[model samples]
Target chain A: MAAGEVSSLEDCLEEHLPPAVLQHVWRMLYGKDTRKLDLPKSALTASLEKDFQLKGFGFEAAIEQLRQPRVVRVGLIQNKILLPTDSPVSEQVAALQKRIADIVEVAAMCGVNIVCLQEAWTMPFAFCTREKLPWTEFAESAEDGQTTRFCQELARKYNLVIVSPILERDEFHGDTLWNTAVVISNSGKVLGKTRKNHIPRVGDFNESTYYMEGNTGHKVFQTQFGRIAVNICFGRHHPLNWLMYSINGAEIIFNPCATVGALSEPMWPIEARNAAIANHCFTCGINRVGTEHFKNEFTSADGQKAHHEFGHFYGSSYVAAPDGSRTPGLSRIEDGLLVAELDLNLCRQINDKWAFKMTGRYELYADELAEAVQPNFDPYIVTE
Target chain B: MAAGEVSSLEDCLEEHLPPAVLQHVWRMLYGKDTRKLDLPKSALTASLEKDFQLKGFGFEAAIEQLRQPRVVRVGLIQNKILLPTDSPVSEQVAALQKRIADIVEVAAMCGVNIVCLQEAWTMPFAFCTREKLPWTEFAESAEDGQTTRFCQELARKYNLVIVSPILERDEFHGDTLWNTAVVISNSGKVLGKTRKNHIPRVGDFNESTYYMEGNTGHKVFQTQFGRIAVNICFGRHHPLNWLMYSINGAEIIFNPCATVGALSEPMWPIEARNAAIANHCFTCGINRVGTEHFKNEFTSADGQKAHHEFGHFYGSSYVAAPDGSRTPGLSRIEDGLLVAELDLNLCRQINDKWAFKMTGRYELYADELAEAVQPNFDPYIVTE
Candidate 1:
């Protein structure tokens, strides 16, 4: 339960269980994470050793289609801050950019039409420190931030849609701060940006100390590849967040998150997959991989002692399809790029089979939610 | 994929895989289904060889509590039709009642405070046959029906609460037929009823043809043991159905289902478990076992050939706690009783830890849903 650890008991059990048994269990439990996509090795991929792990898989659907399958290749990147928390912010940003550029190049080689980075990928996840001077320096304008510029160049060069999540400094609204995702189209133009609607107050997140909830509504971006929406980090916990994106005609929803293992590992697999099933859309769940340490000690209200580091950010990023099938996830201990090819037509096909939209009865729920939110609302409990 | 079969490929794989590997895969994929609850062997349990499978597990939680833990023992029964689908309606009902009596007796002996049976437990699942004669004959009045009266006597004798999901014949309302769960209190009184809100239209489930949407809102019944709600059958597919029960102060939600494997096997685990996580409540997912053969052929919208029976109803009943842990599921091919002891205190404790209620922003979602339900509503999509 300590910081920088991913379940002491699980570690102990992993050591005791046979390797074949562990593999069998995970394969049975998670299904085939993904059938290994045998991509011909490129110069960039072959040159890099274990430093940058690149994985690819495909989610095939069996729905009847009149038109040709609209297969869109998507990439998700989970990486650690290359520099220490005490390192210079500029140096940290530069190191992350260089590492990400290498991975994105590999994704492009593997024909990824769209790609996304982890939440706040440009800098260390240093909100746990609650320090204003140093961490606040990482925030920049989403319109033309250094990170946005870098992603734009890659997106245009590779002809890929890029979703870049960042710490935003909104100067127009009296210099407000927000957690935002900057969507860049394949043509290198800045498509509209969407902010994280939900903020976390639990654990050592201390995100509420930095910024309030986002003002932007749920916005799905229309790109040449597909209609995509980003549900950043903590918003994955709310089913309504996912539902709104689906209601807005989003074909694929990306959840770029920064969460540790002890707090959320058990829930990591279930939530996004459930969202994909409920919404009849594709969902990509991406997480930061390594433990993030702060120069200052922090304490969570869970009675744990004050610690200088958040627990390990277990990276098990994967893609879930509309048909209730998912690709295997990336490694929990490594920085990896998970590339998945999806047929966009599967979205409508799943809806055709399940009829979630037709059977949902959205009007009744709208009334129920409206009534429940009333000040004098009484829960419909049958006391009799 | 044939009627009365679970999965052809899964069966083939099971034949090939070593038993140890299969066990490892199941244990790994499902985690520990449940640590075996060593109950003192009873006469009824001892007498039944493999006819009745009795299983139990305990879900323990760790949280700061001021009051003593409120431990409630719950029992879920997944059963098979005791008679052939074409049998006399009265004989079919009598045969099922005799079988249920034995199961309820075992549950009472296991100290079950509240028990729930699978959907339409007293009759064969003949809805797929789309025949109105024998199936309609099985429908009875909720108040003085033969099934409700039988449950009332058992409830009073054992001082237990029972949830009987039955095909209800509403005598006053034009002899309307509906899928209802009659809540029988410990004193053998009818504690009102809640109907299945969502009806399935896919696969071989011809539910919408038989009944319309339930008039009863998501009703949480306050019993002596705990506040409970029944989201019968297809309601599990809708996240809002589960949320309304939680919003109405339900501590435990029972999903009594009669679905086939080909249609919903992949979804069986994810939906209810995700509900328990999203709602911060305990969810018991119960499914009917075995396949019922009909004299007439049935054809679904799917391209499969006409069949005499619906596909297998793979029974994998299990309990999911507020925390992300779940007990192992029951058998897929057997009639079984899964009893789990839960501390109701875990409900609020999870809410305290996750604060899902506080951060959920229900008002925002209420407005979003309201706008979405409007006839001329425009989705909040970003095209620029």
Candidate 2:
């Protein structure tokens, strides 16, 4: 039958195909794929009964209610409000404000006590465009800005602790630009802000042109629901940024990001989860979705026309517990809100069991990094 | 029917059950399970096809032969040698030596150029026993001890760069003890060694009693295969330990560990993968399998009779590429050899694309950690 089939196909097309190629085609038709997939629990599980034993029991509901006073249901919003590059700054901000308010209302309905927006949630990620004046108009003072007032109103109305990340213009400090997250308490008080410590300089992320590295040290704000900290956008790429927040007593650390699918997709699922497990803290990584196209063509450092259309913002935001169990992520193509109940006691459970911080040789690393960061420092020479 | 069925089973057990208990059982039977799983792929996928795309593609074979000169196949050995706590040190060492030779021969057949064993591979993880005299007999000099000499012979025979981790007693340095990895070159030369920087204080890993923190600043050994670094066992818990190695130009960092399932199973799948992605380097996580039982029960710091049998080692050893694609892991309950052909240039490909090292804000972190590690430093002061 195989020989007959080859002859039958020969009438349809000339036998110009290589003999080896025909052999490969024949094998492809009859061979079973031997490439094994290695997904945990899901890809190769025989039954749900075996899967539960493999992953341990599901999250306990009885112990959860015992610690209800210490639990805060935190919400993360990954909103993708698309606007044209030539859209007015006011229109862009207004569109995001409207969309975020709707999403925050949904979060409130879902009983989220604390909510955080994406990095620079009020504006498009136009730093890649590299145009100074147009983007500068979107920056406002952290205090008494429209975004701050809006978040304060939401916090007061919903009795929620709202974290609003924004592009700030430090008017008192010579209009210095900063990537900042403003913490609004439930009582509408504008608490202190934590600036992003790390900035991106690779490919389309040319954020270094707009702001320098943060001068504000890692700070955990005391809120009514929980001790909260913000590691804005690019700061998620650095583990040290998250470590400092955990050291300063952050029960829940929110990484509000504006990264895209192709640029950070590979790393998006890994870094924050590792930080949550290693540092013994609950980490929420929120990223925006949808594609934002720029009208003006801008050149990257490598001279690529990076402003045509930024990559998809891939809004697969999720909450990772200290014990490494994570909530199902939000959608990758739509504006979504992910709410997770965080038990502050689980942090202590992980810390007491793993004791990474206790076993960590912090002093040695502190001294080494202090020296390693020096301009002339070099430590790779191996003496045999 | 739901109400009727509840009344039917309810006739017998409901009369004895407390109202709260009956309500809980009824809810448990009929309630929608809300414990959402956030695996990168589906919690339960239809096929392995969707899982592969979601996890990014596995190791690519098409990119192999183009740069044949830059490829080095490395193998990691995760051996679970269960020995009685009272066994003679010589007998245990001899047993591990025989089994390891067979595994190394298999690795050679698989074309591995560099090979590494699990942490302190020659003897049982007797730290859980906490009996000093019995385990101390297992310690040998790192220079030319029997373990080193054994590895040298294997390196010479197989033409392999072998990393042998053992409890090292530094006879020349006042008989000081350390957990060290001795690196042997292909021609049987002792290249160098790196001591375990971090030692666990929690659970069964009572290693601090035997050895203090290492003084060897993160050093990379220039080997015939690649520039290698060792972050033995507990060092895997600390991100800075890995960042230092990557900063020192280690293309491949081996984390040979003896951790167990209950204490670290969650973090096990995370830390090494994140280190590979964030640092733009290849990470090899090797953990021993099987359970090691102790005859003499030991007291934990919290005063529990903490010794009996340690948790399952769960030997899911894996190789995480710089692009964040991990090879399929080894068996969970068998002595295994995992060989992976690595493309050294992928490190640069990821680094150039991610630019984490360039954008890492080293100076700021150096200053911050330098202050944070001070003896008097306390950042968790709650004024309220």
Q: What is the TM-score of each candidate against the true structure?
A: 0.93, 0.80
In candidate 2, list every pair of residues with a backbone clash: none
Over B296-374, each residue of candidate 2 has an lDDT whose tens digit, in order, gives 7666565665657776777778788776567656655666666677768778777877788887877777777777778
Highest TM-score among the candidates is held by which one? 1
Residue-level lDDT of model 1, residues A1-384, one tens digit each, is: 123332222243354456655453334344444556777578235526647667778877665647778899999999888888889989988998998898888888888998999999888888887788788889989999888999889988999999999999999998988999999999998997999988988777888898998878889999998899999999998999999999999999999999987677777888899999999999999999887777778777768898888878888888988877787777677788888889899899889888888999999999999999899999988875
Residue B289 alpha-carbon offset, candidate 1, angstroms: 0.7
Q: Fnat for model 2?
A: 0.43
lDDT of each: 0.84, 0.73
What is the DockQ (computed on Cα atoms) for candidate 2? 0.20
**DockQ list for all candidates:** 0.46, 0.20
Task: List, residue by residue over B1-384, the lDDT tens digit for candidate 1.
Answer: 123342222343354456655454333334433555766588245427537777788876665557777889999999888778788989999999988888888888888999999999989888887778878988999999989999999999999999999999999998999999999999999998999999888877887878889999999999999999999988998999999999999999999999876677767788899999999999999999987888888888678888887878888898988877787777777788888999899898889878788888889999999999899999988875
